[model samples]
Target: MVQHFNFFYDESEHSRKINHSTIVSENYYDNFITTIVGWQTADEKIVLKKYLDFEEKYSDRKSDGELKSTTLKKRQFKNGFASLNRDNIEFILDLFSIFDDNVLLYFSITSKIEYIINQLFLNYKNNIWEDMDMMRYSIVKAIVMYQPEEIISGMYENTGELVQLLKTFFNKRINVNKTNPKLKEHETLAFTQILILLDDINVKFDINWNYDIAFHGFKKYLIEKDISKYSLFLDREGDDGNTLKAAKQVGLTFVTEVDSKEITGIRMADMLVGIISKLLKSLHEELRYDSIEDGLNKKILGEGWFNLNEQQLFLYKQLTHIICEVNNAWYKSFCGIYSDDFIILVSLLNYISSFDTVNEIKAVDKKMHGEHFNAYVCKELESYFGRMESKLPIDPIPGGKKDYFYNQRGAKVFFNSSKQPLLKINEGCNIFNVLSVGFSNDGNAMITISENKNFLCYRLPKELFEWAMTCVAFANRGDNVFPSKVQFTKNGDRYYADVL
Candidate 1:
């Protein structure tokens, strides 16, 4: 025999209680009859009736303390089921199938039903003069059971039926020009919520939802109130601009103006880079794992393949060296900039390089002792610096080999030139903390190369004097030396300096 179960509120506050004795067993057909009968007796229906009665009685009078207390009492009576065990309640509800006639009654006895009831009571309680809460609870209850497939089927079954039903209900209860201002507002918000839920259900069920109808209804709902006025733009056409504009107009103070287009581009770039980096890391891991597995599973390479194996290892090391070189090139390109965004980007790139480098080195170190791996890394570094030097016009002067002197103001300056009357170069004047050399690409620019901040170029003949003065001022400003890159444009008409 199928066991019957029922969960109802036990109002006794002393302990967790359920009125298990109320359980009733009936045939499937009789169960439906019993459920409808029980719903009539339920506190939700009773409270709803009382709320409608109160609206009728107090239609002329202003809301008073006694009326408010009465409303609160009705609410308490409706919400009395809050003490029921939720899990056991769900178990009892599962007895009714989706197509069962008792399904509506099952939902009526659940938590969501209780919530709707309390809300309706509260709505009418506050505004006794309003006609009604518009029987929204009934509509929502119907929607909850409507299910996505049913709605789709219903839409096809009668084209105008759904819209007619909605129109009739909305027209009867919702007053656009109601004297009770709160009632007008609540109804509008409730309508919007219902529309959103309908959209959600359609999307979840993969139905061919009508965006025009949904948004149009939402727009109409918003026009009824000033606070929800910005919701009008939610249906507006265009890019993300409409949504952003609406957010701003609604006094959504926390939404920031970070240049949506630029932010989106940056985010996409970051995602792409991150994906590539992960792929590279995965490849490296696979190579190392295969090498270890091969060594364990098979015999060591014969003398014929010894040279091939050595060459393969050599090629792998060279590939890593190339990766490092490319990273260095990227670093050099942006090193002259003072922009915080560029700096952050460079930092992240360097971190990715360092992470990969550390892992590769560790893996190689495991295969060979510290000496072979360390020597290989050093050779790669040497090659990198050699390539850098070949590209630069000025050679690096070694420490102690170069002459250092203090000016009349007692500021130290390092000179490679063995000439008298040393020119005073301020810290900011040295682009990327490197001495300014003749401009590259043309005479329209000057370049300063340094490892810490990289290159600084000052563009044009016009801004040279001002750049010089600014550098001198920075020198006189005491201990905090500014490192920057100054670049001159090709026309010599403008000068650009990376000074932050």
Candidate 2:
């Protein structure tokens, strides 16, 4: 049997990068990283077991009740991961050890500044200013670098007002001022040209620019991965209306949003992204953290942070030593650093490649390292995700077949909302994630019928839902109260679910 893939995606944002550029007065840019950790579905159980075991054994027993990388103090690693206290350092190594040879990684780093500048100029590609993409970028770069601070503080709310602001600012700059200390002489003309060009266009501002481009980048990576069948579970607070449509374009067989708290894979992704982002930062600059705190921001580098035991002290180094060979399918790495100011990316990759284990960083050199460093990774990702596979399981419905399915021997149910019955049948490893009791769509509640694929809703008629859930007594119970193993089977056009 051909094995499919399961991917868990997690994303995080760090402090804005302060660029000492010759362009803007306040050159602050937001840094965002999205990590997709993938493994063969066949090995999903094994990979998940590793995370669970480590969390049980090594979690710091913090009151937050999560063994998350976010909880790890930065001051603990104020010097580097090497300085992380023993307990957390052990967590890091043991956490990653879950992958074995079955895991794959695709990470992309982008910035809001890059997203705005490139997208702003993308429209002018066929216009007279098309050839001057960089000049156009520089013109807008200096203006939006501070982002809703200087010129665009309230411009986003109303485009007409935005245009007026731009018109007022650019008219003065072009006719009266004739020069900006930030922008060069020719860029001044470029700025004036952009303002005039905006008049012909709708001039829309995309609030979801970063996420849209990030998904596009992810889509590109998955396509290059050449995997025919795959399921993606992402941990996010809300839904991206167009993301589902966009993700389907990449031939995803299954996709769903999972709570990181419950999904081991998402939790692992959270840790992976957290560590890698800081790892990159550590590689780029010397640590100058504030004095350690009560794990707040000071006294931050305490014994509990990274003061690891002698045996586990090598774990941090173990991370740096992991082989990043280009041919290694076990871990395919991609870096989508926006190119214009890719020096930081290059310097980090330069250091990564210095170790024979980091061939992954070099993969971006040609794409992100051209002279002006202006080729954005979004384009590279967009180009890579060009082809689609023919004749495959397009979107496999969970448990669509007629068969008797049994939940795990001991399963737990959890609730997300207090107002209504929105049940999550977390069979330990997230087997049956559906079962809504209060839903009254067409005189029925919703119950997901599936084992390990996209959720397929099986609307239980009010009669059956009431009868079955009463046997289960799901309504009155609190979170994680259900501990019975239930069996579900489809008979003809009707479905039968029994609480066994």
Candidate 3:
């Protein structure tokens, strides 16, 4: 019988404070990390023994004999790992080298607060923007559904207080502007209440989101390598086991829980978890974060975010390389073979890369170096357009506009709402309805129609083109379906699409 590959999984978290909070206040971002370690069952004994030897050499906990990531800090070397700073680094590097030799590693990180805020504000829920029907239930579900069990149970225990707070938060009008003091205070308190109510929702979202991504990555590896069966081991503590159900939902067949003390693979995961947590913090600190936090007024990552010392840079390169390499490998296996949905992602990423100059690059480099290295990692790690920032500049490609109205400047044009972006290509096709919806990428959302050919483009902002990709029809041979009629309309910040 062929021996199956066994996988071990673990998670880590880092909470970074973005704003000053007193004892009474609470506002910060919780970044979540999940790492998966996998190896063949035949190597289990060797892997476990290697873990034990490494623990014996570095760990100070004799009774527990399990290496905890929290104790692996550089400053805690005296009482924890019992090695010099450089030695501790080398120890982890050596351990990761072992992992590289024997096991496949993958991780998913999410900044919890960022996701929460985006779901709350930029999404249609705030109602400051468009009143699209799809957004109606989304706000309620995003808030109510993802509550942590503890928060839900606690609310049940104090139903009266919870009800009153909910009533207060809902009844108050949320003013977008801050010129009026009373309205501003009301909005401020309302937001604070919402945050308090959803205190644990962030963690729950983080767990689900990160778990789903990590499992997907692992599954992709299995499929690409043609491995049919594998056993999964998750640390039996906390929410680590919470994702087992999710794994099953995603077609994972075998999973079991193992205590960190009993399994060396999980111990290795524990170390990587901690190391990654630290690296996240160091990476954030290395950047000119003020511009990232405030605005892009100053040069982004110009002061050398990726310009790192040798050791620090090596670790950064190694970890990011592992993620991108693993993901890109999976992407390559199917994207070129089957023309996957990720073809859009490739197009978008290529579009972003086109913006690179002599000094800046948008995507994370495979080696985690080169121009704008810091910007690349930051974009990879953060939400697509979270509260911290807006969409990057996407300048229009000028040659596409052959008609006169498509070249119109500074005019408001609206179209009937449609489902997907309208794409048409032909020689000398320059006759149709022309409406300038809005300016994006310094170009209007213009519509052009010709005899039996309708090309509708530029409805939403360029950032939204990503969401419209799946709906886009690529004009190719064999079978062609083009929208006969399309409409694009913008109501405040919301853009709508309809097709007929």
Candidate 4:
């Protein structure tokens, strides 16, 4: 008689048994199908033929002998395996159906939906649902259970969150690591195709979704912060020369016509520029001053002057002097005064209009663009100094024409020849005195600046085009040089270059 020994099972042993059973079951299933199916299914036969044809077309027989051998072995294995899987032929069919549906959905969303559907029915008739009927059934069941619209709406509400959930679900069912290259590629392709479809749905529904929402939100924030005030002068309709002139005239009339008593103290500062202009014009017409300084002092310090503190009085005098100088200088240089001077004057008026006796001393003169002067006279005067609501009432001077001079090697200078005097290198030929010059990327284009404030662009010559191209590439990547002085500098005796 033999004695029987009993072995006690632990949790680890139980887990091992379960794991082994799963492995055995999978192996058995694979082997069983291999034994049953005799390979050479009509659909797989076609695929194999196509694969062989592609190999023949692209692969050189002499060079790819090793590759061909390996490919042949794989084909033999695939044929043998397919032959053994007769009972599970339906599985192959099911896989085909699932693939077809996925492709259909992808193309449909891409606006090529009709073509994909037609291909599924006409071209893939035999292969459709041939290998994976269970997968096909499951996918169909999912489609029926959850409508496309519902999925789209859910995705719209929380795209990131839903994509994460889908990834988790696929990982659990597929048992493949998401990080695997093949799996990741498939996921990316599928998700991108689905996203294309989602975009179509969003457009059809007239929903303003996606990245633009954030941009619009930012714009709203800027408006709330009063940045829109700066853009007011940029308004095309109201900022024309005629409109600006009318606005200035109206503003001047409004200020001068209203009696000092009728005008609110807060608003008086707003009208200051117009009132001063009118007062100055009157004085210049009726009582000619021997000098500009005397005329300003007489206007502000004389008997009819409004009450002002020491600081206000000082600012008044300073502003008159500054305005007179700017006006005179602009006329002298440009041959005529532009409406730009009026913009500065208006800013000054707004500043003065807000001045109060209590707060006048704290304000200081602030220059506008180095050309015009502005000052804050009082805390109450701050609002009147609001951005010029009116536009310049003049047609902006059209930009000057550019003249380009190119050297044999593609180095070029651009300048407005009509405005600036050019040095004549020959008869009817001029060389621009360029302030700056450089090559753009690819060496084909040259950019230059001239003394007359003009930019020049020219194409490089053909013979040195390649070297010029390289130079351009290098120049684009080089650090920008700010010209301190326009002169020639010699770093070495042989290497002399212009400093810009």
lDDT per residue (tens digit) for residues 1-500 in model 2: 55688988887663222222312343222456777788888888888877788788865654477767667755565445546666666567776566556777766666555554454445544222243444444444445332333344533445445556666666655553242334335545666766766576545655334344446655655544556578898775656534445455655548887777778888888887787666545432331222111112111122222323443434534543432432243214433323322333333333423433323324444333332122333343234323111111122112323232222322221222122234343323223444333332233454544346433434444445655455334332222223344555544445455555
Q: Write the per-residue lDDT of candidate 1 for residues 261-326, one digit (tens) a residue.
A: 222222212222222223222222222213211322212111221112222333323323332342
Instruction: TM-score for candidate 1, please give it.
Output: 0.16
- The order of the candidates by lDDT, greatest first, is 2, 3, 1, 4
List TM-score per model, in order.
0.16, 0.50, 0.46, 0.17
TM-score ranking from best candidate downward: 2, 3, 4, 1
Sequence-dependent TM-score of model 4: 0.17
Q: Give lDDT per model, in order.
A: 0.28, 0.49, 0.44, 0.27
| Top TM-score hit | 2
Give one digit per residue, the lDDT tens place, for model 3 in 42-157.
87788778777877777564445556776656343221121235765576566665554566665555544334334333323222232222222222322332333332333334
Candidate 2 Cα deviation (angstroms), residue 42: 2.8
**Stretch of 10 with least lDDT, candidate 4:** 29-38
Q: Is candidate 3 or candidate 4 better by TM-score?
A: 3
Of 2 and 3, which scores higher on lDDT? 2
Q: Which stretches of candidate 3 lie over 4 Å from their true place?
A: 1-3, 14-29, 61-63, 74-84, 114-217, 238-241, 285-321, 324-328, 331-471, 474-500
